[model samples]
Target: MRILVLANFGMGLYNFRKELLKELIKNNHEVFISLPKDEYKPKLEEIGCEFIDTPVSRRGTNPITDFKLFMNYKKIIKEIKPDIVLTYTIKPNVYGGLACRVTKTPCIVNITGLGTAVENGGVLQRITLYLYRISLKKVNCVFFQNEENKKTLIKSKAIVGKNMVLPGSGVNLEHYNLMEYPKPQVVNFLFISRIMKEKGIDQYLEAASYLKQKYSNVNFHIVGFCESEYKNKLTNMQDKGVIEYHGKQSDVKRFYEISHCTVHPSYYPEGMSNVLLESAACGRPIITTNRSGCGEVVDEGVNGYKVKPENSNDLIEKMEKFLNLSYETKVKMGLSGRRKVEIQFNRRTVIDTYLAEIHNITER
Candidate 1:
């Protein structure tokens, strides 16, 4: 079987679904990946994937550009003639699914995140919901990362095919092995995510600022790409020594190794947060928003604690609890997180699910 994977960004495929693609290759399936060419292209190529440079503009919401993207997907699907098409991200899932439908190709879409457009609930959300309803009407399978996201889709009448919930792309337990919790003199709290407003970055910053005044020994670190608009603010905060901001790190495991807890105060609708998953896999306790996908990862003070979405005070309270806890208790919390990942969010489970779905689509 020949499988064509479509996504908005190339690196995302390499980072998250590389194992699944490798599994496909091991099973003797020809794999083709279509995404905007970037540094990760070489990595995917090295893994025996035929790469097609796709023109996918992540920030382009213009009608003409989107129509062109649709046409491009149609051209690629027609040329590749794949046995099954798997898509991720917003534009690819919507436009690519439409192309798959038009080309009479079996398609599966992974609802990674609903995004701010849907979360904000406006004209764009209405338009997106309508587009999704039409585009996914004929898709063979729709993979949702969590039940809340699935319910949102069903409530919006977007999916017309079989829907399956996955464990948020699932974490590679071997790659992110559980390690002994670090026992640094000062407590370290790390936030790993793209610096976006919807991701509750503002809340994290506010919490860090307030906590810093009281707890001089505690350190706050952020590791991810800061959006252009938020760069200056983050730089200013870094200059003031309020937080240490390492812009876009490829090797996040090193930072996780030193960190005591992972904070992902995200209000953005996510399928499941990869940051929290990796942190847990690395045996770090998490403090995230009490919302779908993000909230589901926590067992409420078992593995970690869930704070109210966009509430800096609530986040401060949780972080304070971590600071006040004994080192041994925190280590136990970290171990609990590792256990949760092994039981529910292992990457092997995700790979097996994809393989089964692909076989079902092709064999049928």
Candidate 2:
């Protein structure tokens, strides 16, 4: 089968869907990936997948630009005549699905997250939901990273009836296998996410400040690219010694190895958070918001803690729990996290699920 995979960014497809792509190739499927051109093009090509540049804005909604994107995707779909189309993220899932519909090609859309527009709830949110409902009508299957998103789609009538749900992009257990819970001289807490205010960076900074006042032995690390809209806020957080911002890291495993705990206080709606899964796979406990995708990963006291979204006090309390845990208990929590991923969020399970769905759709 010839498969076309569409995502917003090249790096997103390269990093998140590599296992699925490899599995398809192993099964003698020809794969073509469409994404915004990025430095990761070489890496995508190296994986034996053809890459096509599709310009897209990661943030905000513009109908004019989106229509152009839709037309561009429609042209690509007509030209490729792929046996099946699989899409991820917001724009691709919406516009790509629509384009595939025009070509009478089967589409499998993965709703990674609802994004800020939906979470914020306004005219844009309503319009996006309307578009989603229309686009999804022709999709053969819809995969969701979290139950909340799946439920939301169903409630909004965007998707209904037994939709597939997978845990994030399923972390590669072999690649992010359990590491010894590092015993650094100073305890380090790392927040790995795009520098977005909606991700609760402000709350994280506040918690870090609160923690630092009492616990001088702790260090806060922030990893990810700073978006221009949120750059000034990130800068202010850095100036306050709230976080040691390590912008856009290719080697996140290194940070995971050294960090004591992974924190993602995202108040914005998320699909399943990849960082939480990777951290858990790396045998690190997480501190994230008590919201849909973020809360689902942690089993409360078992592996990690969940705090109220955008509430620094709640985050501070959770951080204190980690700080207060006995060394043995901390190790045990990390091990529990690894076990959870092995059973529920393994990469093989995700890849197999995707392949099975794709085959089912094409066979029909």
Note the clash tally of each candidate. Answer: 0, 1
Per-residue C-alpha lDDT of model 2 across residues 118-151, encoded as one tens digit per residue: 8879898899899998899878999999888888
10 residues in a row with least lDDT, candidate 1: 179-188
Off by over 4 Å in 1: none
My TM-score estimates for the predictions, one after another, are 0.98, 0.95
What are the per-residue Cα lDDT tens digits for candidate 1 across 202-303? 999998999999988899999998889999999899999999998898779999998999999998888899999999999999999988889878988888
**288 Cα displacement, candidate 1 (Å):** 0.2
The 0-to-1 C-alpha lDDT of every candidate, in the order given, reads 0.91, 0.87
Looking at model 2, the pairs that clash are: 224-248
Error of 1 at 277 (Å): 0.3
**Model 2's lDDT to the true fold?**
0.87
